[model samples]
Structures are given as structure tokens and as C-alpha cells.
Target: MLDLHTHVVPAGIPFAASLAADDPRWARLERGTTTGDVLVAGKVFRTVPRVAWDLHHRRESVEAEGGTGQLLSAMPELLASWAPARQGLDFARAFNDWLADELPGHDGFFTGLGVVPLADPEAAAAELGQIAAAGLSGVELPANPPTAPLHAPEWSGFLDEAERLGLLVFLHAVGSPAAQWFPQPMAANGVLFPNSIGEGVAGLIATGALARRPRLRILASHGGGSLPAQLARLDFLRDITPPLQELMPEPATVSARRVWFDPLLFDTGLLSHLVTTVGADRIVLGTDYPFMPVDPVAVLDDPALPAGLADAVRHTNPGALIATLRSHVQQRS
Candidate 1:
């Protein structure tokens, strides 16, 4: 399986110290804590130290689990989105440089998606160009900024550049301040479900980002963040709402299909629904590895899926996507 949503950390990232920083977002909001030998979010994550990006270790882990290769990128926490644009850009460059330097010539077992600073578009565009030249496969950005949606005019230039360069844009969910919605309190001290994957998708669609970057190959993490369930509502609004009709004249499913989704939804029911709604061609395999050890085989082995669908999700689709950026690198060389 291609495993499109696994995360890796740059060697330069301070794994332990970054937890104790004064940033309230990482402190109060996410509440990082050490447990036995792993780190668990006060709310949603439980991860081991080994998961932090050792290619040898990852290869062994995947081989043990019966998978073939991993498509790796920096985790949302590693991106440090709460930091200022300049700092975020620096972190991105350092992370991407480390990936380029380390992952090649390792039996082609590892591939990478570069990180870009969405907080500043011009700088991000330049960084995107640099990453493309460096032979990275794609660029990663947050699903939405804490303060604003990605479609805000300030970020359109970066989207434009990514499309022009034929770079795949990957959007991962990051920490948010609003988290008081879950019925049961899973964590002793932090918020839960303030705004979820669904809300992020709504924000992206409402902002007209898909319309703006028509040809950009964009993938949304965590199964497009609650989008499969909300398609009916979006279609209703598009059919009746005059303003929305003007903005998105096509059926809502068309826009939904234009954006691909990774299979990071842990629940089988939800994953199946996402595949049915988006079609098998648009669904890609994503384990969100190291954060959670989702069984790739179990996800693909389900009886609900049609024949050949698993092969597309596991290999063909993502290989094609990565090949797009790889071709750019070949031309540059």
C-alpha cells in the first residue's frame, strides 16, 4: 500500500522541549503530556517516540504490518502553525531539506511531501518553488488557519503557484482553540470538538478555494474532515441559494470529487461512506501512521469494497499523484 497520510519529523525538530514551550496553543489547548514512554494529547493523540521519523524503524514497522511503502510528510504539530509566518517558513525549509537529504536511495521505500508557510503567500510561493526544485513530491499546508480560512485573498497567490507548478497540495488538520462540543469529556483538562473536520471543509468550500484552484491536485486529511456526511446539505444549498449557485454552478459532488480524500477515518462505516460518496477513483490509502497504528490490510480487505478498488486506493492513485511532481523534478534535472 502507498500509505499517503503518514507523518515524519525533521531531525532538527526538538521533540521533547517543544512540548514545554510557553505557547498556549500547545500548552493549554493541546496539553502535551508524557506517558510511560509515549506522548498523548490531553485530548486526541497517543504516540510513541519511535514514530517520530526513523526511516529504518518505519520500514521495519510497515514490513511487519505487511505493507510496502510509506508516503511521508511532517505532522501538523511539527509544522508549528501557531508560530509567525517567517518562523514557520524557516521550519518548513529545514524539514524539507532534511527529507531530501535523507530519504533518497533507500530502496525507493520513502517519498515526501514538502511543507509551506500558509500564513504568508508570497514567501510560501517562493518556498514552493524551492521545494519543487529540490525534488520533493508535493507541498503540505493546514486545512484552515486558526484565524482565517485558506481561501482568504492573502493565500490565493500560493494556491495559484502550486497549481501552476503542478504540485499536489495536502491539507492536514491542526490544533484549534474551540473544543467544547463532545458529549463526554475524554481528557481531564482540555477542549474537544470545538470545530471539527466537517467545519474545516465547510470553511474551505464557502471560501471558494476549489473554484479558485481548478486544476490543483488537492488532498484533504482525515477523510476530507467530515465532508462525506455533509454533501447533501451542500447540494441543497447550491440548488436553492442564489449566491452559492453563482459561485458553484456544478453539482456539489463535482467539487467534492475534484478534491481527493485520504482514508484516515478509523471507522469502517465512515470510510465506506466516504468511498461511496466520492467514488473509488478519488479515495487514496492513508493510515495516519505512528499517531495510530491503523491496519492497512484490514482497511483494504473489507468485503464492502469492490474488486480492484483496493488496488487503486493502495497503489495506483497515489503513485499517479506522486508521479506528477516527480516528473517536474525529472524535467528540472
Candidate 2:
């Protein structure tokens, strides 16, 4: 199995220490050691360790699960929270450099998903360029900006460049800040645990960003964040909106077909629904390993899953996606 959603923390990237100093958002919050201790949507939930960074520790987990390849992403929300564009860009470059050195030469067991300075698009474009040059498989961006929606005009250029370079754009939920912005009670009631994930998908659909970058491959994490449920509503909106009609022949067509969904979902029913809604070919296996006790095979083995779809989710989908970006790097080289 090729685990698509594994996370890694590079050796040089300060873990808790950096969060305490540089990241005010998480620093102020009361953090817990285990997944249950961490608060999301005003409820305490356990937080899983990011295992991909620790090669030795993860080897057993990977081997135990019959995993042959692991795609590593930077610790969640690491680059997204940097306030300044320059600082975010610098942090992204440093993180990618560390990952490049650490991931390669591991018997081809590991590949990296580069992080971009989404706080600054120019910086993001530059980082994307560097990632393409380095021949990394893809780049990761927060599903929603730590502070804003990613489909805003500021992010368009970065998406454009990613499309031009043939980089796979992976977006994962980093939680929402509505609770932080409003009073605790109001925030608690109004904020959804994984609502940001849905917002990120909606933002992309509304902004016509996907339409603008047709060739760019986008992977949305957490079952595309409630997208499967709202397909009809988005489709109705598309019929009424001129911009969407002009950009896409069908309203939710771009999102339904163009964007891919990952299988990090803990609920078997949800995973099955996503496969049925998005089509198995568009779904890929994402364990969100280390942070979650995910058994890739168990997810694949779910009785509801189609026969051959398991192999595609586990290996073929990710391999094909990675091959596209790697080909670009080879051509450049």
C-alpha cells in the first residue's frame, strides 16, 4: 500500500518549541499530549503523533501494515500560520530542504510533499518553482488558510503556477478560527469541528479557481470536507451563476471530477459514500498516519468498497499522480 496522508516533522524543524514561540494560535491554547487532550470545536479530542518523520519508528508500522511507499507531508498547519509572507516563505524553504535531505536514500521507501508559503503567493510561486526543480512529487497547502480562505485572489497566482508546472496541489484541513475570532460560547456553537474543510472546498468551487486551472491536479483531504453531501446544492448554484457557467459547463463538475478525495476518514460509512459519490478512481488512500491509528488495509478491506478499487486507492492513484509531477522534473533536468 502507498499511504498518501502520512505526516513527518523534519529533524531540524523545532516541534513544540516553535509552536510556543512563533505560533501564537496554538501557543495560547491549552494543549494535551495525546489526541484526546487537544481541543477541536470546543471538545477535547486525541491528537495522533506524526510518525513519518521518525523513520525507524514508522518502519514497523509501515511493515506491519504492508505499506511499500509513504508520502510525507509537513506537520499540519506548520507553514500556514506564519503571519508574514517572507517569514512563511523562508520557513517553507527551510522545511522542504530538510525533508529533501531526510526523505531520499531511504531505499525509495519515502517521498515528500513540499509545503508552500501560502501566506504569500509570490513566495508560494517561488517555492513551487523550487519544488518542481527538485523533482518532489507534489506540494501541500492548508484546506483553508489559518487566517483566511485559500480561494481568495491572493492565492490564484500560486494555483496558476502550480498548474503551469504540473504540480499536484494537496489541501488538508487545519481547523477553523471562528471560535478564536468570536466569544467562546458563540464560537463553540457556530464553529463546526471540521467545517473549515468544507469551507475550503466551497471556496474553490465558488472562486472558479479550479476552472481557471484545469490541468492542475488537486487532492482535497478529509473526504473533500463534506463535499459529497452538498453536491446538489453546488450544482444548483452553478446553473444560476454566469461566471461558473462560463468557466465550467456543469456547476460542480470540476469539483466532482477534477478534484480527488483522500481516505483519511475514520468512519467506514463515510469512506464508502465518498467512493460512490466521487467514483473510486478519483479516491486515494490517505491514512493520516501517526496522527491517527489508521489501518490502510482495513480501510481498503471494508466490504462496501469495490473489488479492484482497493488497489487503486492504496497504490495506483498516488503513483499515477506522482508520476505526472516527476515527469516534469525529468524534462527540466
Candidate 3:
């Protein structure tokens, strides 16, 4: 299986630590006597097995389940975009370096996405070249960032730069403040992570940001989150709302077709509905490796999926990111 949506926390933190009494901020992995814990802001983030960083163990675990290879991402907590701009950018660059060193894995089987510091939009935009030069294919972006809204002018450079570099973008849910506006700053996801991807991606489309980044290949993680279910309502509103009608060149459903999604919604019926909405060709496979207990492949390979479509997602549809990684590795060889 070419499991694309997997994560890892390096067993070490090469950077210095900030252990303050009143203010604590840092992201690292602490290896316990037996297991390891991912720590963000000096708090225990996730207690993970060696599979989180042990390359041999990770490969063995996947092979035992008949998986051929896995793409890797740094754990979300490591993104640390909530930190100050320079601090966040430092973490992202360091993490990208660490992740790139692990790639072309054990004979070209492993590839991964680097993380960026959205708090510093310009720096994040500038780091894409370093990420690519380091042998990474793309970067994972937080769906909602504490900076200016993704559709704001500041973010256009970043999005356009990613497109120009042919970088793949995977937007993962991260509940965040809608913007830096204080006193009455709105929260993007009132319920935190659950509603983030939907509101974030939908806002981009409604505000015409996605349209601006016409060539940027973005994947809406977690089955486009809640966006897929709200397409009909958005389309209806667009048809009636004069401003939205003028802003959106296409209906919300058609606009959504430009984005890619994975079938990790955790429901068979919902998966079928996603296929009906987005078409099978736009779907990709992701197992979220070392996190889920059961075989994540079972979701994509479920008998309930349309005939032969599941096979297409598994064998043929590795998506732009993996395909780019393959080309990068080939060039190096």
C-alpha cells in the first residue's frame, strides 16, 4: 500500500529547549523507558510506539500488514504555528531538514511532506525551495491559521509560490483563530478541530482564493472534512447570493472538484457518497499509519466501495505528491 497520510516524530530534538516557569513553548519527542511521548509546549502530546520514528520498526509493521511503503509527515503538534513568527519558522525549517534526511527510504520506498510556519507567511512561502532542494515533495498546511485569513492578500504569495514550485499541499485540520484581529477575533472552528477543514477550505473557495491558485494541487484531508456534505447548501446560496454568484465562477460543487480528497471519513456509506460527489478518480489512499489500530487499508479496500474503483485508488491514484516524489527520486538515481 502507498499509504500517503502517515506521520512521525523524530526520536530526537536537535534544537535547544525553552523550559520557562510562567511561559513554556517547545515541540519534541521524549523517549520513556519503554515508549515515547510527543511533547508540545512541554505537555505530553501523544504516547507512541517506536513505530513513530524507528524506521526498521515502521517498515516491518507495514510489511507485516502487506503494505509496500508509506509516505511520512511530521506530527501536527510539531507544526507549532501558534508560536511567535520567527520561532515557528525555526521549528518548521529544522523539522523539514530532519524529515528530508529520512527520505528515499530504505531503497526509495519512503517519501514525506515537510511542515511550514504559516504564522510567517512570507517565510513559509520562501521555504518551499529549501524543502524541495532537500528532497521533500511538499508541505502540510494547517487548515485554519492564526495569521491573516488564507484568502487575504498576504497569503496569496505563499499559495502562488507553491503552485509555481509544483508543490503538493495537504491541508490538515487545526482549529485556529480566524485572524490576528484581537478583542473580538473570531474562532474558525467553534468546536475546535472537527469543523476546521470545512470552514477553512469553503472560505477559500467562496472568497476566490482557491481560484487564484488555479494550479496548486491541494488535498482536503479527512474526506474534505465537512465540506463535501455542505456542497449542496453552498451551491444553493451561491445561486441566489449576488456577490457570491459573481465571485464564484463555478458552482461550489464544481469548484470542489478541483481539490483532491482521501477516503478517511471512517464510514462506508459516507465513502460511497464522497465518490458520488467527487468522482472516484479524485480520491486517494491514506492510512494515518501508527495511529489507527486496525488496518487502515481496509477502508479503501472495503467491498462496499464501487467495483474496481477501490483498486484504482490504491494502485493508480497515488496523487500529485507521490507522483512528484517518484520523479524526484528518479532524477537523483
Candidate 4:
């Protein structure tokens, strides 16, 4: 089965602090007596996992997990859009170079979804052209990039560039520093943070970004993070709120269908509900492999699912999402 929402690290890419030794936003990887943690400005940001860079073992693990193939993206933590433009560009180039190196040897099992310098959208668009030519399907992006929201007017150029380049945008989210603003002892510093994915999707819908780029393929991670549930409410708000009406002016539900969601909700009922809301054709199989504690294969194998729904999620839908890249990949093999 095809797995879309998996992550990987380049073999020799350094910690952000090493790349931008002078940038305060960059984090250094600190090795401790028992564990490793990333320190940003000399404070512990988060602990990391070995599988983040353990390529061969990750390959074997995915194989054992029964995936025929996976789309590899740099973990969102490494997306480092807050870095200065030059440093960000350097990191993006290194990430793309590593993927280019890795893809030639592993024909069917690996597909590269490279990173971009989102801090500079013009540069990002230019690099996306190179990534497309390199046979990668698309790029992975943080839903809440440092520069702006996904649908902000400043992002229109980049969105148009991506659409023009025919690259699918995989929108994933990591914890945001803004999580601190929620309240003391908030779960947001951990679990609730990534719900930014939902915020990004809803923001895009509310602002009519999907309508502007009807053909722009976006695969939202973390089961599109509460977005499906918020669809009706967003639609209602659009009608009653004059400001939202001016922005969206159309039903939010119509725009929601433009996105593809991965079934990483970690619940059978949630997955079934998402499938029903978005339709099976718009759902893809995603494991968040070797990271999140969910079983994509088990979900697909659930006997309670509608007939052919599992197979469609596991294979058919993904194939359609990456149709051009799949054809390119088949030609290479």
C-alpha cells in the first residue's frame, strides 16, 4: 500500500544551529548522558528520535509494516523557516540534494517530497521548479509558516507559483511557539499544538484560497485535524459574519473537498467519519510512520469499513493524488 505521511532526515544534514551558527532561531542538538535534546537559544526545545535519521532501519521498518512504498519528507521540525534567508536556502538545498542522492537506488520503495525555503517564497518557488524537474512529486510544508498563514495575500504569489509548477503541497504542522499564549499548564504545549493543521485548513477555506487554486493538490496531515468537524460551522460563520462573507462569500464546504486528508486520526470511527464527509476518493493512507503511534494498515484492514473503501484509501486515492509523479517514477524504473 502507498503511505504518504511519512518523514525522513538527510544523512549528513546538520542541526539548524550548525547551519546558521549565528542565527538565534536555530537549535543545536545537545547530547546528554542518557538522551539527546534540541536546544534553541540554549534552552531545551524538544527531545528527538533516532529514527529521524536512521534510514536503513526506517526502510526495513516500513517494509515490515507492509508498505509497498512511502513518500519521504523532512520532519517539520527541520523545516526551519524562521532562519535567515541564506541559511534557510542552504538547508533546503542540502535536503533536496540528499533526496536526489537517495532516490536513484530505491526505485519503488521511496518517493522524495523535498523541502523549500518558505521564508522566501520567491526562492521557494524557484527551488520547487528544480524539485519538480528532479522527479520529486512535491514539497512538505508547515501549515503555519513563520512568514504568514497559508492563505494570506503575501502567500498568493507562492501559491500561484506552486500551482503553475504542478507540485502537490503536503501541509503538515509541528508545535508552534504561540502555544505558550494559550494558558499555564495548557495541553497545547504538547498535544493541542498540532491542531494548527485544522486552523490552517479552516483559514484557507475561510479566505477562499482553495477556490483560487482549484487544481492545487494539498494533502493535509493528522486527519486534517478537526477541520472536517468545523466545516459546517465555518460555513455558517461565513453566512452570518459580514467580514467572513466578504472573504469567503461562498460555502466553506465546497472548498473543503479540494483537499485530501490522511487517516491518521488514530481512531476507526474518526477515519470512517472523515471518509464519509470527504468521500473515499479524497482520503489517502497515511501512517505518520515510526513517529505517531497509529496503525495505518490495521485501519485499512478493518472489516467494518465499506466494501472497497480500504483498498481505495490504501492505493487508488494515493495513485490519483500523485498521478503525474507515479507516471514519471514508472518511466524511471
Backbone clashes under 3 angstroms, per model: 4, 6, 0, 0
Can you write out model 1's per-residue Cα lDDT over 155-202, one digit (the tens) per residue?
777778888887888887654554344444444112222235556665
Off by over 4 Å in 1: 14-47, 180-195, 294-297
Task: Kindly list the per-residue Cα lDDT of model 3 for residues 118-151, writing each as its tens digit.
Answer: 7788988898888877877778987877687676
> Which regions of candidate 3 fall more than 4 Å away from where they truly are?
18-23, 176-192, 319-321, 328-333
Tens-place lDDT digits, model 4, residues 186-230: 467346544778888888888888887887878898888878778
Better of 1 and 4 by lDDT: 4
Alpha-carbon error at 35 in model 3, in Å? 2.2
Best prediction by TM-score: 3
Question: What is the lDDT of every predicted structure here?
Answer: 0.69, 0.68, 0.74, 0.75
lDDT of 1 at 268: 71
Better of 3 and 4 by TM-score: 3
Q: Mark the regions of model 2 whose C-alpha exceeds 4 Å error after superposition.
A: 15-52, 146-148, 179-193, 241-244, 294-299
Worst 10 residues of 4 by lDDT: 9-18
Q: Which model, 2 or 3, shows the larger TM-score?
A: 3
**What's the true lDDT of residue 298 in model 4?**
75
Candidate 4 Cα misplacement greater than 4 A, ranges: 15-20, 23-51, 54-56, 178-186, 189-194, 239-250, 293-304, 328-333
How far off is model 2, as Cα RMSD?
4.9
